[model samples]
Target: MAADLVRRLAAEALGTAMLVATVVGSGIMADRLTDDVALALLGNTVPTGAILFVLITILGPVSGAHFNPAVTLVSALQRALPWRAAGLYVVAQVLGGIAGTIVAHLMFDVPALALGAQPRTGMTQWLSESVATFGLLLTILIAARSRPQAVPALVGSYIVAAYWFTASTSFANPAVTLARALTPTFSGIRPDDVPLFIVAQLSGALLAAGFCRWFLAPEQAT
Candidate 1:
């Protein structure tokens, strides 16, 4: 059991670290190559999607590859995971996100931009986060419960799509959002804005949990 727990936690941390690194690293590198944020964002999207697909497959057996609190929370609510394990997963994810951001800050040169940080506080930004998070949770539930084998590719595609569709660039992970705040480099959120974004994300996650309970009721009962 102890060994299993260690493996789970390690998977969670590694998955989350890869997630943040994929977004921040790719974005920063792209920005250095091209001045266009749009081009850079597009460039990041490909690798982000590819990485998520591979990571989910690689880590799913150990930790379910839930690199976000929202994903873990919703999964727990859906009975896909126990609350205890979900709690540990969330902690691991958050810590991984922070560590990944710190590494990105150290590795990349400082830019005029706020390190590809997430937006906070504005009504539009909050709304974007809410929508993005809802979509993320919804995707997880749908993918995991219905098409379990397809989860890796489906989730990766969904996240990449959400990035372009959502105003807040679909940063649906609170841990990742917080980690971004710590970096002043490519993808950091402002420290002042971190709390509000996290609040919005948590709220969105809770709402997704409730909705998933109702929508996936048949599956949950099984």
Candidate 2:
């Protein structure tokens, strides 16, 4: 059990690191390649979504591919994962995500620990985060229960759509949010705004969990 847990933790860390690297790296590349904001966003969004599908597909068997703290929290609440393991998962994810930011910075020849200046805050932003996370959790819970084989594709697709639809570009993961704050690149969020974004994300996750608990319940035989 201990050995298995260790492997799982390693998978989570590595997976999250790769995920964040894609996000930050793609954002940097996009910004440099284009002056058009929409085209740059497209560049960032496609790589992120593609990497997510690839990561989740390859890593899901090992650690359930929960690169997000919000996802881990919901899984623990649902008893799909133990609380202690969940805590470790969050730690690994956060550390890995931070490492990813550093990797992206090194790749781009930027300051490794620069604090983000991009201000991603305000009521609409918070609401977008809440909605984004809510949709993410709900999609995961429903798809995992019903069509487990399609989770990678479903999650990737949802994120792709969410990016275009949400006001905040759907930063639904706490670990990702925290990591992005360390980069002053196109994908970064202000350090000051991380806390509330996380709060909104967690709130959305819990709401999804609660709704699923009741909504996905097995129908009682009459």
Candidate 3:
């Protein structure tokens, strides 16, 4: 049991690091394609989603693949994971994200960007973030509850879509956004904008967690 727990923690750290690496690495590529934001984004989206899908499947059994703090909190609130595990997982994810961002910055020879903060509170931007984050959380809960077989594709596709559709570019993962700030690449967020975006994401996640109670129902959740 102890060995399994250790493995799970390590998996969480490694998986999160990979996720951040994808974001930062892609950002570096996108920066080279700067004049064309759309193309740059497209370039980044494919690998980001693809890697996320594979990582989730690879690490899901071991760490439950809660690469985002919001995901971990939501899962724990639903009793899908223990509270202690949730906190530890969040810490690992955050650290991994930071490490990944740093490595990507050095590897790509780009100055680190500000923390990847969520976009600000313009009506459209805020709505975009709220919707994006809500969609991500909703997708996870639904996949976990009903379509277990389809989770890999569903989660990946949802994130890919969110990146294009949302103004904040679907920074659904707070840890990821924070890490991205450390690198001035395609995926980095500005430190100044981090707090607001985080607030929005956390709020969105809380709403989603509440929605889960209704959507999944008491017996269904367990």
TM-score of each: 0.89, 0.98, 0.91
Record all residue pairs in model 1 with backbone atoms less than 3 Å apart, i.e. clashing: 115-185, 115-186, 115-187, 115-188, 116-186, 116-187, 117-187, 117-188, 117-189
User: How many Å off is the CA of 22 in candidate 3?
Assistant: 0.5
Task: List clash counts for every candidate, in order.
Answer: 9, 0, 10
In candidate 3, stretches whose alpha carbon ends up further than 4 angstroms from where it belongs are 111-123, 218-222
Clashing pairs in 3: 27-186, 112-184, 113-183, 113-184, 114-181, 115-181, 115-189, 116-181, 116-189, 117-189
**TM-score of candidate 2 on Cα atoms, chains taken together:** 0.98
Candidate 3, 65-150: lDDT as tens digits: 88899888888887878998888889998998888887777777765544444335566666676788888899988787788867
lDDT of 1 by residue, 1-222 (tens): 879988999999988988887777887788789988899889888888899999999999888888988888877876878899888988999889877765665677543224444445598888888888888777777777789999999889988998899877878888888777766654667778877777778788888778877888887788
Predicted structure 1, TM vs. truth = 0.89
- Would you list the C-alpha lDDT of every candidate in the order shown? 0.80, 0.95, 0.81
Put the candidates in TM-score order, highest first: 2, 3, 1
lDDT of 2 by residue, 1-222 (tens): 999999999999999999999999999999999999999999999999999999999999999999999999999987989999999999999999999999999999998889998999999999999999999999999999889999999999999999999999999999999999999999999999999999999999999999988888773221
